[model samples]
Target: MAVVRSLRQYVEPVVFGAQMACSFFDTGLQMVVKQRSENATSPSDPHEDQNAIANFYMIFNMLTDFIPILPALILARIGDRGYRKVPIVVPLVGYSLSRALLLLVIWLEWRIEVMYVAPVIYGLCGGFSSYWAGVIALVSVSTSEEQRSLRIMRIELVYGIAGFLGSLASGHLFQLYTVGMKQGVLLASMSVALYVFCLLYATCVLQVSRITLERRESTSSGIITHNRQDRTIIALLFISGILYDVAVAGGVQILSVYVLNAPLEWSASEVGYGNAAGFLIFITSFLGMKFFTRFAVSDTSMIMIGMVSFMTGIYFMTFVTTTAMYFLARSVMLFALIPMPTIRSLLSKQVQGTSYGMTFICLQVSFTLASVATAPIYTKIYESTLDTYPGFVFTLSSIITFLSILPISVVGCRAAKQENYERIQGN
Candidate 1:
């Protein structure tokens, strides 16, 4: 009973369920888009079908990344004002409604173009940017500074595990159909139902409390002079984060469409398995963190290790021709999940606890803004290289990943200097 009560304070349940729903929706939408595009284009021109799918995603992803910016900021402000759940609950509502729209499209045979409005309604309610930042803010304020990194990583681990399980089942679920129902109806309906569960869980069950505004204002007011080093570190962290995100997001956005094309030509089940393989990094990363932390590894060092892992893996991705080679490349990225959460943990340490929501949202919104330019550019690159060199975008991602490492190295040098100075001053 005590354990159950203790667990009641967590938001992991909502993360788990919502991620599961997202996995289902992702597979369903991908296969649906594939089918529709194939039906509209001649089989002789596979490149045209691939381009159509890529074009749909280029706009769809932009809307997903762009529309939520203002609402997310507003919701973050509200979260900082004391209503912690508002940021989370509102976005879950958007998630549920948007996923339900897909279900309608699947069941009624509406044109896929109708789905464009989904992100609009979703963005108005604050979207994933607000939702995740809210969750991180709550977790950051509740945990001690020393334990924050592990706590955040644990949350990410739960999110990944849920996605893995959902992806494993999604392919089989997508094939479930009756005479009157469409192929994806069951999967789409499951996504809607799970999102509704997440909404309810967030609304009524997930327990959180407001960080005291008086304390926050007092801390802010009391710090008359901001530390120059801390500000520099924050700026550096943001730069590293933005560059890494652009690489990962642009690469992933194209990879999804790439798998559905020739050479691999992955079926629904294969696609689900491939996504599930990607989520495995979360588990491996969590384990890697535990091992590294036990050895007293610095956060920046851990981040560098993760960055290198992704760099190598994405470079290898440029040469993937067989399914086995694809998995081998994925296996090389075992630590790729470490950088972002650890970066967030580092950012949380640099700010007052009360500003966690706003700071995290600023970082997320920055990622979204970068994606606005990079997503379309990646699609264009993919389209241009489809027949000759389809993996060019992956190679580009690897280059960006290497570039992201430079700012982080600067951060490591600055952080070490600050620590040594503080130690000498104390002595």
Candidate 2:
């Protein structure tokens, strides 16, 4: 009985590990397919082929981001209604199916274009947006308001650690037994198995806290409203959060392809290493938050620091022609992870406990919409500049990240003014 209880306690971590493993596999597999597709098409020029394949990849991802919004919202609403596991379990099922489809694509040597269908299926089943919103809601309910940021960051830390480990091994897995079997087949198989385990574990072991649920129910109808100034601050935070996420997503989605084509052609192992470096952003960002909090730094200050770190790192990426430079650029952006979680934490504080699901849902919707626009635009810019400056996309990302800082700064100033006013009134 004790063993069983201990195992139950690990359900969330197990689910998170599975999800991260699948993501690593998907990332590596997509890179492999992109390269394979470019080789098979044999365009007149290598750069043109690269451009076309990257555009297709971005478009497919954009579709996935856009198509999942409605289903994700519906699933989040259902989760908020007390069926919390529905959103989590359904998305796992979708993820497993989509990963399986990639295995099929590998076995049959199908065209990469057919892979787009997998994401559509995954989106219809609720996708990452729904899965994440549910997880956030569950975590939010499990902790007090004072503990919320730390709790959420702890979850993200688990996610990052899992991603880092998975990424470190994924490249080796992809290249394993390359002589006896198809590349990435073994890795994809492992991904599918992990996701299947995730689905089963979540269904069988994860449970909602009845106390938290009851509290949420009692408090659902009593969310407090803010003054106009405060409302403006919240709105600016939301806008900045959306823009920051879009820039991050667009930059990351194309990073694999970017490294694969450039003067610094990285091998599968190198790709894994590069990805691990990116995952480290989560760990470092969490640590940075803790460090800042010890000094009682304001949330807005942390956010601004994160934005500047991201902008600086991305700008450096535009000049990266060597692997060392790439990793250095990533290292400089360790603080980049601060903004999103801080923004989410702030938003959570502003709303009623019961509304965490809806808040996350709205955030995901805005993120998706921004991604839909950003992906295609970045893809077009990257493709157009393939011959002259393939790294131009990074420059654009840096610029957009800089723009995100404006809204955040506005919110910060408003917050400072409010604090001063409150202190004066108290005197």
Candidate 3:
């Protein structure tokens, strides 16, 4: 019974399976968009195809980030009310349905624009914003404050490993179509099937408990005294997270389109390999977290280290014309995934355990809202500079990354002062 209960507590199954499915869906969608864009062009122009692809993704990403706001908020509220599985399971339903639509599009010879509905339904069902927040909230409640960051990173590690394996297989699976079936049919089918499994597992097999306030305050005086400082820290973390998200999102968005054009045009297999390289960062970041935690490094300092790692790597990304240079740039970003999860861990400490769902959702929603502006602006920058210097947007991303570091630096300084003050008080 004890072993069974322990096994039931594991959320990694859903995390791993869902991320694997998403990997297949991502590669499949990109290839489908590329195929449709090329087929629709009157003249065989790579530039036109590139623009079409970029335009499609810009709108696609915008709707994805925009449409989930209200639904995700409602779902988060519900999760905070104790039904944690609702947010996660409902989104899996959307995932299963949305991914199935891609299979239908491929199998039925439907127009590519039909694929846009996927995000609408996905968003309406609460999308990644609610689902991810719910997962984070669950993890936060289950672990102690001291171990929260490492546990969250472990989840990210599982997610990344799943993505890496799925990506390595996706390109070949996408190319495995027969005369009767179309390209990506098998991959999409597998994606839908995996999501259904996740949905069922989350609904039936996974066990979760609602977390209440960690401790009852003996007096309200301590709470009042710390409220202002806590709020400031929370605000700074939000700003830092938003800025970092924008930089990463913008650069990655452009990179997907960039790799398909000009000097380093990558094939489906190469695209999958490139994606795998990106997921490799999660492993490095998790290991870095462990090492730093062993040495008693502060979370804020870890976040700064990650921001600098990304800043340098993205700046280098501006010069990557060959695949070798691209991977080299990626190598420098080994800790890039550390900041966000660490930020979430810090945020969770600022509030009562019962509010974890709402707190996390707010952070996720902020990222979503910020991405609304980020998508189109980055898209325009990429489109405008496609001819002269396509790598310009990456440089712009590098600048934003540097700006993100400032807020985190302030957070680190504040934490240092608090630690010193506590030591002096103890003395």
Candidate 4:
């Protein structure tokens, strides 16, 4: 019984890691397929084709992000009302179905345009925004306040490690050969298999943290009311987090297009390696947080440090001409992963136990809204500058990231005032 209970404790994180790995692998493989299809059709002008395809891809992603807001809110409300697994399990099902559609596209040699349907299906099932919100809510409610950051980081570490391994192997998997098999079919199949496993584990093995349930019951009545100052700080923090996410999302979306064209025509293998480098950011940021917390750094300070690191790295990326330079830029952004998760931890701490799901829902909504605006803007910028300066998107990202710091500064000051006030009251 003891061993069984101990093993059960590991199931949620394992499932989360598996889901992340498969998602990243699927994303990388999808990019390769899109690139290949575009290349096959427009062999004379691969650069122009790449820009067009990238725009289509980002538009599809933006639609998925936009369409899911209502459904995500509904699912998150359900989860908060005691059906936590619904949000997680349903998204895994959607993910598996979407990946399976890609396999069909590969095997049947369907038009690349058919791929657009998959994101709509994914959105109907609540999409990644809902899934991640549910997972964060679970982590937030389960852990104690003091250890919440570390606990969330542990999940993030597993997610990063899984993505690292998946990305390292995904390119090689795309190159796999088998009798009567199309290129990338095997990789897509593997992604579907992993999603299936994740879905099953989440359905059968995962349980709500008992501590979370107890706290929710005990604190249900008092969770909604907060004084004006904390509310102001949280609002500023959310605004900052949303802007920062916009920079991150726009930068990553354009980076894919940038790497696939012009001076750096990376192969499938090289793309995987680049993605692995990106995944390493999570591991390094986790380590940075651990080290800084040991020295008693505040969450706001950690967030400021991370934003600075991201801005500097992105600024450097604007001038990257070679693969080595790209990787070097990624390395400089090692601490860039800190701000989002730390902001999440801080937000979770501000609210009462029963409000975790709602808080994360708002965060997801903010991200969705940011994506709606940023995706098309970045896509247009990349398309227009394809001839002259495709890397201009990174410069824009750095500017937006720099702007994100102002709200963080406001949040930090407000938090400090609250802390000092509590200290004085305690005396």
Across residues 1-427, which tens digit of lDDT does each residue of candidate 2 receive?
8887655644366546675666666665756666676677666766766676686778778878988899998888888777878888888888889888888877788877777888898899888888888887777766666666777877778888888888888888877766668878888888988888888889888767677677754553343444322678678988999989978998887786788776877778888888889888989989998998889898889999999999999889988999999999999999998898788878876776667788888998899988888788888888788778878888888988988999988888888997898799999
* Residue pair clashes in candidate 1: none
Order of the predicted models by TM-score, top scorer first: 1, 3, 4, 2
Candidate 3 minimal-lDDT segment of 10 residues: 212-221
**Worst ten-residue run, lDDT, model 1?**
220-229
Report the C-alpha lDDT of model 3 over 130-184, residue by residue, as the tens digit: 8999899888777777788999999999999999999899988999988888888
lDDT of candidate model 3 versus the reference: 0.89
Q: Could you give candidate 4's per-residue lDDT for residues 1-427 as a string of tens digits?
A: 8877666656455445565556455554556556555766667865657767686768777877897788888889898887777888888888889878888887887877777787888788888888888888887776766888887887787778778878888888888868899878888888888888888888888777677577754553354354423678788889999999999999998887778776887887887888888888889999999999999999999999999999999989999999999999999999998998888988887776667788898898899998998799899888888778878999999999999999999888888987798799999
Candidate 2 residue pairs in clash (backbone atoms < 3 Å): none
Tell me the spans in candidate 4 whose CA falls farther than 4 Å from its real position. Answer: 10-17, 20-28, 216-229
Q: Model 4 residue 411 lDDT? A: 85
lDDT of 1 by residue, 1-427 (tens): 8787667678899999999999999999999898888888898975889899999999899999999999999999999887888999999999999999989988898888888898999999999899999999888777766888999999999999999999999999999999998899999999999999989988887776444334544554344234423788999999999999999999889889988988999999999999999999999999999999999999999999999999999999999998999999999999999999999999877777668889999999999999999998999998988878989999999999999999999999998998898799999
Model 3 bad stretches (over 4 Å): 210-229
TM-score of each: 0.96, 0.93, 0.96, 0.95
CA lDDT, every prediction? Answer: 0.90, 0.80, 0.89, 0.81
In terms of lDDT, which candidate is stronger, 2 or 4?
4
